[model samples]
Target: MKFTIILSILFCTSIWIPQNPDLTLDTRKDPVSLKEAAKNHFKIGVALNERQLNGMDDKALEITKQHFNAIVAENCMKSGRIQPVEGEFVWEHADRFVAFGEENNMEINGHTLIWHSQAPRWFFVDDEGNDVSKEVLIERMRTHINTVVGRYKGRVHTWDVVNETILDDGSWRQSKFYEIIGEDFVKIAFTLAHEADPDARLFYNDYSMAKPGKREGVVKMVSNLQKQGVKIDGIGMQGHVGLDHPSLEEFEKSIQAFAALGLEVLITEMDVSVLPSPSNHQGAEITDTFEYQKEINPYTEGLTKEAEQEFHDRYMDFFRLFDKYSDHITRVTFWGVTDGHSWKNNFPVRGRTDYPLLFDRSYQAKPVVKSIADFLQNP
Candidate 1:
């Protein structure tokens, strides 16, 4: 009888109960604070300049620096935009980014030097306005990579050597880059990046690779790169999720699959977009009456409360998953510093309002931040 009682007590004690069973992650009740959470986690980075960084009134930047190991300058070091006229590498923003990291002793990540979207127009054409041949493109790629990557060889810790090469449908994206330079461009870029800075880690970053098809494509790409003697170091899955899209199970599978591929995974550019429109709510009610009138604030016209809550809920839930898989995820980068400057608020579907990030314009940590902090610390 005593043995039975002892066994019962032991079983009950062994049963895992989440710290807050009520699913309430109020910051007040959060004994496990952000500072505590960040201690056990990888990194936290905000994408903005001095205005936003200095805008944090409560010395949040100092507080955050105490926790996060690294910072990524969102767009300060892109291809054409950073070095617009070619050979005239404007170091204004890039210098500031590196300086901030130095000042804080933070491991800096150079966002990218090669990507399809933000390349300068001159890169696409020769002095004669004709499409540059693959040779010239490769030279330009090497030169650009050498110049930029070389500039911060030891200072910057990692580089998103390649970004968004795969499409959402798990196919190679059809861009002027791929169309002109061929698949070899990807390999050459990484090789040159490695040559420029043999010590720095290199990564291939993309979004929507959480989907099975896209995951498979990435698996193949990474495997092929490995076989070809390329120094491809990591893969970054941009976790830009909608409330209802890519269920948690699917996301977990993606994580497990990538980790199984023997590469470090970074949950780069994570944000859950809850827009100001009803359709933004996954299960929003729709009248069969073909009324375009519902499209009021076409950008953020119809965000429902339920959807907002769901968006917030998923943000927490995803972090819980992050905590569970923290062993695999090396970093979690919030795309922007605040909702006010989020790319989701406008882009792809331009003029649409988006509330995809964790902080408001004021840099106050939102519930999502608390949720993530809670999980990171407690777990």
Candidate 2:
């Protein structure tokens, strides 16, 4: 009877258990982070805001150090934050941001050198508030890039030299840069950024790149830059996705499209929100506004088990895709360290509760964290 029972127990265990057993075993260990899980795959990064950078939120800071191997300043490194006036550069915030990255031994990503938004109001206007001449604007741009990029040439490794220059239709967004310098603004921006730090890798970053038109536009732009002898290193696809929008097929198609080019692909500003949109609009534009309704912000109290499980499944699917293309991807960065700090709560609609990252508001690893580790480890 004892021998029969032992054989039966072994048979039942094999039927219920994972083939390798390590997959199930890893999930039982202390939560493993995206960085460690993807350490061999690619860099894992997070964007830090002023409070987190200053350590005002100690727990958020602690969590960031534990998971991220790369860091990008959420606002400190932007043009407006770094240089609000014509020549006066605000060094306090930017300095600390870089210092924090250096201390953590994280690869620092300079948020941007030239962007249509978050640029100082003074950049496009003269003393009397008239639009500046193209030559003057270009000169000011070079100076801004030189100063900021020179300050941290060796310390910061990658830079978004220009952002959101391509529209969804694959045409140039008619911004101050384009209107002032025509289409050559992108070329000039990359040139000056490279001049400031030749060693620093420069990237063209944008949102909605999963759209076929936008992807084609970016690819054409990068190809043109290469033909013109520009030093474009990578393309940053801002991964601000929701639970339902952006089918995995579309996102993967973009990854394949971008990798076909010679540059490395970076999944930047990543976040997957598990909440209903106020107006069903999917965008991260600062100017986008929506009226807050409790009905729309149902998850303000917190996500239900069903919602949480769906979020877990969505994140796992995305990471599986990331791992599949890890060879072509250089880095994958979360937009924020924790859900509490996510801009999704305020973007497109304000004061709406959202859970978008691997960490919860309490800075605890969500169940998805363990799953991500197991997925990559087992795969």
Candidate 3:
């Protein structure tokens, strides 16, 4: 009876081996990056500036190469910066941006094809300084899209064809394109982008995407485009989230709704500002600049322990949410690399020391980075 019991125990303890044990990532690597940690889930990206593109900011570029697998031009690719004057394409900066991405094997995203701000003054206004006629504007739009999109035809994997077109109230933001070409401008932009690079993905990026009205409106608008047989592949919810505003629940709703519309969701421009706002809630707009004040820039010394903890929690929560919907989200691109590189430092209120990004000013990973990296390690 004792021998039988021993044999049964040995049989029960026998090991079983799988055919593909390597399919699971060994997450025990130390000092892992946000991009590598979450790579199996989805891509991690960062936007680039002139310094990084020109190889001036060696530290930022090194961190980028180590951690990130995707890149977008922070300003160089913008219409105003690239074109400046009509028909005079300044391709040097953009070329470098693409070259950097290609060398690193990173997925490249073109920031914008049409936006009200940051375009050459000549883009919308005529030689007489008036808004150009619809025909002239559409033709100019066609040329701009074709030229820019055609330049990086297969290099850029995705393009922000139209940016921030809808307001929080679900109404179209009136710009030269809206006033002259009407809503059809969105369709035209997508068509031109598709014509320029049919293989590349096309996306409509916007801010305030979590609001119910805006979410609904974007769904309907994109649905209409899909109905018209326009190949809109993704929607970029500018992740310019704050510590408290735009509740996580609402943001998830935006993802679910967009995914329901059969569109992939890209969390573009993600950063969490941990500073008291001048107004109720500030936005990421080039026109939304403010005069620097001593009081608003309170964290110049450094963030308080409480504030830092809160910032860390906010990031972990958002990333956990991102993990939850990893299937629907194809990419999550931080707007900047480190806290020092963030635009939030001067946005809405200038000179404010906002601790909004995953890395500190020194490019060291913060607690939130560890939290995310740890999570990825475990999974």
Q: Report each candidate's C-alpha RMSD, comma-separated, in the order given.
A: 6.6, 7.3, 8.9
Using TM-score as the yardstick, the better of models 1 and 2 is 2
Alpha-carbon deviation at 27 in model 1, angstroms: 3.8
TM-score for each candidate, following the candidate numbering: 0.82, 0.92, 0.90
Give the Cα lDDT of each candidate. Answer: 0.70, 0.84, 0.84
lDDT of 3 by residue, 58-158 (tens): 88898789889999889998899989988999998899999999999999999889988787889888878988899999999999999999989999999
Pairs of colliding residues, candidate 3: none
Sort order, lDDT high to low = 2, 3, 1
Cα TM-score of candidate 2: 0.92
Off by over 4 Å in 2: 1-29
In the predicted model 1, the residue pairs found to clash are 80-120, 276-300, 276-302, 276-303, 277-302, 277-303, 278-302, 299-352, 299-353
Q: Is candidate 1 or candidate 2 better by lDDT?
A: 2
Could you give candidate 1's per-residue lDDT for residues 190-254 as a string of tens digits? 99999999999899988776678788888888888889999987888787777667688888898
Best by lDDT: 2
Q: How close is candidate 3 to the true structure, as a TM-score?
A: 0.90
Model 1: residues >4 Å from true position, as ranges? 1-35, 50-67, 276-308
